[model samples]
Target chain A: MKKLINDADDYVDEMLDGMVAAHPDAVRRLPETKVLVRSDAPVEGTVGVVSGGGSGHEPTHAGYLGEGMLDGAAAGEVFTSPTGDELAEMVRACDGGEGVLCVVKNYEGDVMNFDTAAEMAEIQGDVAVEQVVVNDDVAVEDSTYTSGRRGVCGTILVHKCAGAKAAEGADLDEVKRVAEKTIENVATMGTALTSCVTPAKGEPTFDLGEDELELGIGIHGEPGVERTGMLSADEVADRLTAAVLDDLEPSGEVATVVNGMGGTPLSELYIVQRRLSELLDEEGLDVAEAMVGDYMTSLDMRGCSITVLDLDDELRELLGRPAHTPALTV
Target chain B: MKKLINDADDYVDEMLDGMVAAHPDAVRRLPETKVLVRSDAPVEGTVGVVSGGGSGHEPTHAGYLGEGMLDGAAAGEVFTSPTGDELAEMVRACDGGEGVLCVVKNYEGDVMNFDTAAEMAEIQGDVAVEQVVVNDDVAVEDSTYTSGRRGVCGTILVHKCAGAKAAEGADLDEVKRVAEKTIENVATMGTALTSCVTPAKGEPTFDLGEDELELGIGIHGEPGVERTGMLSADEVADRLTAAVLDDLEPSGEVATVVNGMGGTPLSELYIVQRRLSELLDEEGLDVAEAMVGDYMTSLDMRGCSITVLDLDDELRELLGRPAHTPALTV
Candidate 1:
């Protein structure tokens, strides 16, 4: 196993320090609970938003917490969801006057832990709590087998919609509604050009040949829907877009996102976007907005995903709103 | 050479298609220019924001274009800058009534290409253009030598600040002022635990022996200032943060960012952030905000970086304002 660092044990703690060193304006550490928060948090009467998941997806939870977004984000070890206790601590830190909204991606560990936190928050005080599960990946046809569809890249969409509402001083219920509405309009499907290796594991998450790609890959290097020989850019676009469009049934207007898994490039995303516009035009869907980038990524996984969200005027306006965080801005 | 791609020739186009298939709302392709834009675009009286870089940094340029950020983005081939012609086409499509502001990472190739586009736009008529070159990486002593610093994760800071100003209806000069102010205040330094392998180049970008890391690495996989034996996470954070502090001179209040090189997990980033805050506290500096995640990355390179931005009220308010895009929110 090849790796770097004097000791693996202190990796998480040390990295957290570096993060604070980098962005003092956006985050602060809770010494007692090890939770991270926006530096000037508990913003008066604002409802707090808290989220967390496995740590490998950087910028997902903590990085997303700030004004107009999450107030606090708890992180677990790499690829491991936070425990209920940890989340409970974060809930305590983030609970403001109105309530607290938990934006959880629909992963088993995440849901369970966040659910526990919600319950704990209720037991602790008058803190109102609500949980919104983001299950936007359309690749998984049925949620029956595995606690519903895995929340893929589309979780970012949920964050924006809910975060915007929260920023506007919406109550927790309204925020939850916005989050749910975003989820309903959104659908996602992704492919993997290659496998990502975990440093601790010291091996590739999955294996693939040079001429092959995995369709419908999960973020944690899990098996995608299919491993097939390579296809043309247009063909792949057709398949992925068809799946999302079918799921959304987006009429009038929609938002499109072309996401790069860790290793692809902007050039490739543009090429894919070209084909995507044509397909949407052919379908007579008015493209209200489009974003192509590595918004949500699986570390070093080469490939891209397409996500479409059917939007009404309100959603469109919200999507156009300005936001600030480490990785994105409008 | 091991790779997951079928053929080199078709990789970019295929990847693009895959991205579009995944995101219909955030992106649309202008076939004529091979550029990607937000589905809700050509908004009246808004300054068009455009950015592009080499292809390997997926979503850095294209994924960021949409809604409140960029009007259009041009993607170059993997690790290569786009031609001026391509950029000009993007400019033409994205330029709204207000004007156009180009946010460029400081790279020779990128600078040349975007500068060419600016010149071309001037030739085209009725387009006001201004650019801000991001030079936030503290690794290089200067920006004019073969061994000069290469722009790394710090480019994201440029995007947020500049994009926010553009979104707020700042004129071309104001956008430039905001971008330049961020560039002056922000500084970044990175370390890589392991090197990454690019498909175009079958071998890894560089080799690091087991238990080693390269500090002050460039985003394009350029050599860093030092390659040393692996150190503790605190030591790693110290090296990176010290470099940034030395460059930015964080006196009163500061903002921080701990970014992964794609492969590092949130667990690691959190650890780094924790230590960084302690370090800053020891230094007697007031931390305004902090962010931890994978903002900018070098493929799946296993490493982390620290960015410190000495802030004033304007920068802070700009940072705090509501903004939205695919990956981040304010």
Candidate 2:
């Protein structure tokens, strides 16, 4: 209810306009659409990478648009899926001579709409399109908006790898292969200290006691597996990491992400990161790379998520490649 | 009181450990001190740039350590200035045979401690040092923890400009001049929706009703100039910009920063940025550069600060120069 916003209906449009204004050199909005693309998108003969979802999780789809990341991203309303028409426009805008790849999260609305958009692009513009759905969240098998597992912070890892692969001039099929590989290897689990309030709702999506937390919570404020008393930072890290590692089951090396759910301070994220590093070391998992920040956030939710990616040579190399985006740069 | 931390006593140390763990390639902690230095510190012939203060402001002094930002940073307990001894050690470590420039924020404790550290470095190791104290907040003439106007988010601008000057092989005096010039031109004002709780305190530093806001709140939750009912995002932007522009009275070519106070979502910050840009355009001021994110923060506080820096040719050019740091890379 205390969010800084004007008219609730104008939230998404104003935010998109602000993003373009702040980083005009890095990203721009497509004409007459809720889609954002790289300033110089649709390169002549390379695969175009596109992804999108709801609006609350910022720096996700749009912030990842740049040279070695997404080419286009269509944003829906807060916690709502974009329409098929808007998504089709995004696909067409990002398409080069080669093809377009859609990296989607595993939500029922998102999956169906992206499928429809891909079909529309193929039928209307003769642009070949491929899709890879990310179901990396090991928190729940089914949730409020998803059928299988919910996709959480691990989706950023997919964006990194698949976008790098496409930027390396891979064909649509190869890019799809990399995206699927990333989805298969990554696992995420999250907890929420407080629920976020949508602009339209103007109240918290759910109620949590002052001293309670929701374990394995979905990004959309859906019910988690457990609601329990507060735990220490180390205990929370252990629980989240244990769940992710059990799902991932890696042997030699891995990459890790300690993503904050929007409202948590960066200092706290580093504290979680420290414990996670110690936990990984104890398990004999050599960390190939580590990222600690708010990559995919759920509005102003005060929580954190842990992600583990079982890395092979290809995924490690691809992740290490340079990427230039609004929220991420390497 | 809900924070992701271990024992409150271990908060600073663990956070520092986590930061170094998460970014080993870019930053490293001094062996026994809470000081973080660039991985390649004491660059043989370049002037060193060092800044530090309380630990709550993540990515402020420490996160700016790199080739073109800061050479070293010393951290103290939450909301407490670093000791003169630890800061002196940081100065000694960052001395690159040329000299070192210390950028101190204009809090009473920070200014006094940094002065002591500078004197200690001169008397102990004979390292040439110059200090520039930034007091850019136009909120009030004097308040708790400060002698003059409080230094808030605009300190980051001083860091960027002075750091770039130091990286470009400027001498100690030249770097000091640039830092002073930046401090003179920049003005900032902030407001808070909810108060923050320090790790040690474990309670909100201040109180606010459900529908109230504190205008011109200090970074440490000090009392602001006025407390009023909630306002829309556009109204908030208008008030903040009016205060800044009245103090700055700029003609043309300015840079702006819309900084979130940790708990505010990026979406809201962008909303503020959109309004600020519109206001600046109406004033006939060309935005040379704009940054919108949580560059400087008060731990988990739900609010934002707007900073306007009147840029000239030298400052504009230095702002555009390439710099690489953990939190900011350009």
Tens-digit lDDT track for model 1 on B1-330? 433343666555555554555565667777854467776776667788888876666556665665566677676766778889888777777777777888878788888888899889878855778887777788886544223456666677777777778887878788888888988888898888877666577677888898778988877777687999887777888888888888777788888887767655455566677778888889998877676665676665678888888889888877766555554556
DockQ of each: 0.28, 0.82
Query: What docking tier does model 1 reach?
Result: acceptable
Error at A203, model 2, angstroms: 1.5
Q: Write the per-residue lDDT of candidate 2 for residues B265-294, one digit (tens) a residue.
A: 999999999999999999999998889888
In the range A182-296, model 2's lDDT, one tens digit per residue, is: 9999999999999988999988889999999999998887758999899888989999999999988998999999999999999999999999999999999898888888888
- Return the top candidate by DockQ: 2
What DockQ does predicted model 1 obtain? 0.28
Cα distance off (Å), candidate 2, residue A285: 2.0
Worst 10 residues of 2 chain A by lDDT: A216-225
| lDDT for each candidate structure | 0.74, 0.91
